[model samples]
Target: MRRDATSSARARIGAALLLLLSGSVVAAGEGDWPAFGRDPSNGHHSPLTTIDRSNVARLRPTWIFQSGVTGYFQAEPVIVEGVMYVSTTGNHVAALDAKTGRVLWTYTHKARTEKIFGPPSNRGVAVSEGLVFEATMDGRVIALDAKTGRLVWDQEAVRPEEGETETASALAATLGDKPVQGSSRLGFKMPPLVAEGLVIVGVTGAGYGLHVEDEKGGLDGGSVVGIEGGYGRRGWLAAYDAKTGAERWRWYVTKEDGWEGVFAETTPDGIPLNRDIAAEKAAAEKNRDAWKVGGGSLWMTPAYDPALGLIFLGTGNPAPQNFGLTRPGDNLYTMSLVALDVRTGQLRWHFQQVPHEQWGYDVASPPFLVEATTPDGQVKAVAQASKTGFIYLHERTTGRLLARSEPLITHKNLFAPPSPEGTVVSPGPLGAISWHPVAYDAVSNRAFAQVRHGAATYTIKTVPASGNRPELRYTETSEAKGEPTFSTLTAIDLASGKAVWSKKAGSRLSGGTLSTAGGLVFSGEEDGHLDAHDAGTGEILWRFQCGAGIGGPPVTYAVDGRQYVAVAAGGASFTKASGFGTGDALVVFALPD
Candidate 1:
């Protein structure tokens, strides 16, 4: 359970573990936030500790950089030496002095504006070998000069499948929207994971369905409606040469064979799925070609272990948006934590969280690696935060589940099918940890999650065929009306596998949590406050209002013996109706010298 080490003992253990776990992973320097998740392991814990629990109250804004290009600021800034590289929501890359917030250079990414899936978002960029690389929202990957932000090379990674626009229209019709309002659903939204000289990125929005756009110009608030028919592209994770942008390897999330795999009646953890096995089998035979459009969007940065030569990542929901009767069989690879050969793109092992899932419980969070104690002894483990409200831990080598941390949020009417009248799912599609990364502290044996509180009302609307249209039934899962929403930062004890404490995080949590060696947990709020909590007790130690939704993870680094913390603020592109703020600023904080 818990390896409770303190101070000197903990430091010794953490150092040893870091060295052992550094297989192919970019172990970020103490003063650099070189990679998203702080390092390739996706562990958002910074080793810098200048502004610790003692002086954190004195933390003040040191500088603010405005990118003018505003929207959802989901990209994590990458820093090296004293320079900072940031990819904007519009796929533009800007280089700034990490110390003074001075603009150095800006590289404008020419993104094809049409026929893309979902509204555009460039989650982040990867920097290596003096080059900055980003995966575009329009299905391409490009590399630029790290110092000058000059375009170094550009390569097309993926092209939209033919008839994608028509499919978008058909899916959007359920929500009664304009053609332009239809979601462009196949593109990249995750920061690249550059390791072993290869730039790794994954495709998102491959999971079909018009993710409803609200009046605020965001794809949030409305119900996710699924229509009958096969209209999704296969999702995949690929690796390209960081220098030349040449393709190296590509791994499709859904497998070509054995995808049906006995049509499991329960999840891998033995939770009964209440599956209509017989019906699924019949549908399987009739839809044997469903694998062609099987949606397994990979939208998060994968964690890598150079020692194991394997990279870990979680996959999203299958396409057609959650009506189980459409695509039958176990739908191999989607909604799972999978380990792949970093050099080959071949699947090494997989652990599916929701088999034949209909609840939209995609493994939306990225997996991270940590050293934990098992029955046998100390072992390297990989963990992922699931939309279903648990942090899954598994043995690093075998993919064997070791333990699941306590629930980060409440669950009610789980796995129950949507009734024609409507069924309430406490964690509808917006999971407890909605794509927000969790922060873990090995010394404390705890993990921190920024969780949302709310539920969705799933109503089934069965349509009878009019001429040329077949009878169809689908679930319109919408935000449960009249439900008051809030966010919380919960600390889960890995040793006890229980929630140790939780602090109310504003009206809504805009991003994930970031913990530091300084023993503080930091998270953003929809109300524009970036708060720091005591890592051990979940107490608010300090806070600063960014005045814009802090829509990205908090990152910390050091410059000239001074430690600085930074986060992005922009009103959320989605959820304005929910009261989340928007803007275009990256604020940095530090103690006054």
Candidate 2:
């Protein structure tokens, strides 16, 4: 079907099925973890009470589903009604029976095999009315029939118009006789957030590997295009109509014309050529030449708060992985938390944790929204734990910064001066938090978060400019390596930003955290154990050994008035190289009633 006609298909509505169940609403019925982080709040908190603490010891293995693809199965499943929707590698979406873990339907998109792109791993899927939504590793937005898993529409979201922008080069282009510079070129890869009949999404370009051969013969670099709050393609935030796929609006980050590198061939001066970038044109000739693509993708899901009317999304780091200089100016919003208007795509507020990031401090963790009371006795607000290693508290109503808690880790020579307004700190690039969603408990007004404690040493060097590549150079110092360190889960009092309780795990690299009203906290270890902790005091209560290591989030639900806990023991993907266990198993636990 054509992109315009997809909106008129009323049959798609029939595909959305509303299941009515008297017990626990069937959200935790099978292995389907519907919606990212269960619901938009990114809470990863399940109301299903079937498997409570008393009998949780008796919980046993139920079944397993093999994805047949390897990389990272970081996505959680979504269980709507009695049906579960899950995404495996190779852009495959499967519908399974919640009770028996049986595959009901499947759809797969075969990606190109020969390219050197990142491994194919799925974070999760979203469903609405009768359609299921998913994003591919190669940058495509696909809509599938929710009931049958049939293809509805698949559209490539990143396609830059020719001659739209250019990049920089080496040496100088003279206005009669002087040195000059280059400009920027840009594309996409942020998993989208859907709500109120629209899909809100961002883009990830502008780093290395995204260069194109410029008309000038030399190559230039680019910037991100869909970020609404910044520059380069305006860094627009777009809202596409869910039913019709029409663009609603766009918000740009800034309006300054970008720069490009410049170098001359012969003589003392080059041509007085101006790159087409809106500003800083006279000083450079935009290298609109050959450029590579892909890297710094938005690999996690954003959270939504309908009550507060805001969508929370964290962005990835600047391109080329471990180098700076090529990109500058705090790289606004890259390693920041953005609160956007659900209906307008307007930027409500933002907090950039790492300005001009040198390491991979991606703010990509699902923004866990917690509504709790503060210490002064009369303040109620929301909170989030950033991968940058700080627990940020804000007045959710106004996006006001309340406080931040830095992890207790030793640094060799790192120094981040706190802004006059607040303290600046390094949370480690793996993030004090990653894609694994954390857990929140309203009863105690405390949020549980997991993090790694270590140092990643890297350096950059400029290479000689040549071919259709940009003169601007970036290469990480491989001599600097990462030091192994400890890991743990810390419970923070939202009001005072104080660490109330903490339990040390084996290593900094581990799985997500979960909390419950049952007085339990659930999480995994790099050593392959899924343990349950006391929510308030951080005491180890019980643990189960899985067939593989636990690297995904654990959820709890009630079925027929009995409570159960389910975890994905698939191990780590993007972080750990490959020796870790990568089985496609869903381990369900329960207590003896």
Candidate 3:
């Protein structure tokens, strides 16, 4: 079917399937989680009420599926027909019996290249039409038989990490550092979204900013050293045929019109941005080809709106993330909430949070769809908990701003430019919310966000011209140990744009939130506690020490009329510096049968 004509017909309406049960209209499919956010709305809310606030206290561990893969475990298991399909860090997928902890089948990815150009973390898998689709770290899209773990078709969707090692080696040599071979390239961080007979996937780590080993390295090398002018590659989102793996339509993130807009001095909501207009315009003329390598990677999973045939997602910061001069002019679509036509991959609308992004303020958290009450009664809306520490609510169809909630986290020097010596700023590159999934409960019109409180000192240091190397000056950041930081789980009432309740986490709250119809919100912490909170009061009702940091989202599903809450507890949710224990355990909790 042609995309433009049959798009709406092929799209699945994610609104609940109304099944008349016991003389009442009840939403069905709440017993299983089929996608990362469960449905196309990406609300992360389950309507199963078996484990409500009263009985949730009796929930206990029933089974544990150990992935045995080390490092970050951020997989949100996809459950369907009593089977759980999940992905781990090393591009591995497994099929497990949702009732028992039995491993049915496992598909170990044999990489096209061992060198990971991007983040190796695989969030989860998408299950559609009897096929389990996974976006691998080595830049390939593979589909497995949904029943058995047999390979169906494999396609190299992303270009191989071409010239990545060369770029990393060159930068390392210039800075008297050794280049890590495997860290040069990029990969897919989240699972692909399969909709309308098409599998949509995006590339990660397309930006020039390199990942640093230590906190000190984060300042000096991570984002500060934006060298070689055109080191980054343009990011894109492409859709391919679900069965044959054929390309359908592709959309490039950066604008073709030079990526330089009106050089706006304020954000879309009129917040003053710290930028030098005259200096940037002059620098833009000097580096006229910078837009070719504009940095704007898609970092989070998006929600598809069947009504509008649009996909809403959050794009990362501009390339050379922390530094500003290279690709100027509001950076077009980078660091914004973008709405793209699902069928043709055409840009429908965009709302940029930061223009000429210098502070690494990405619209990092995934945006979810909601039916919000407006002056015109009820309208479909999209809401996001951003790195800017505010919850932005926008009218879905036209991308009009509805409300900007109060800051979920503290903010000090927002949009401040990097200083020579160092200027400390709150909600820095690590972000107020770094790629964490937010949960929304339509019954209460509340959104739960996981926020981190931290600061970074942005310093621009100049290395004098060496014997052969040219003089270079770049912005870097240093760990501000003197400044105290913490994390919190905040609940914002979407209707009034106010925080209804907030609870300070027991430890570093690095995980995502999941709200269920049982009047409960499940979240995890770096200290190995998977906690269940009262959705209305923000009170911790239950806690389970899982022996690893619970950085992933907890999912709830029903098997044989019994409800279960499952989460993966992998060690060190924040970083190794935090000293949180690491492990690979997918813990499932349920009330005694």
Q: Where in model 1 is the C-alpha error above 4 Å? A: 1-27, 160-167, 171-184, 213-219, 482-484
Model 1: worst 10 consecutive residues (lDDT sum): 1-10
Query: If both were scored by lDDT, which would come out higher, candidate 1 or candidate 2?
Result: 1
lDDT at residue 382 of model 3 (Cα atoms): 96
Clash numbers, per candidate: 17, 80, 9
Task: For model 3, name the residue pairs that clash.
Answer: 117-185, 117-186, 118-185, 118-186, 118-187, 219-477, 224-475, 295-319, 571-582
Ranking by lDDT: 1, 3, 2
Candidate that would win on TM-score: 1
RMSD of each predicted structure: 3.1, 12.3, 5.9
The TM-score ranking, best first, is 1, 3, 2
lDDT per residue as tens, model 2, 345-440 = 777886655554445666666676765555554443545576656677666666666666655344443433212122222444555577667777
RMSD of 2: 12.3
Model 3 worst lDDT run, 10 consecutive residues = 18-27
What lDDT does each candidate get? 0.79, 0.53, 0.78
How well is each residue in 372-401 modelled by candidate 3, as lDDT tens digits?
888889988999888878989999888999
Summed over model 2, clashes come to 80
Worst 10 residues of 2 by lDDT: 220-229
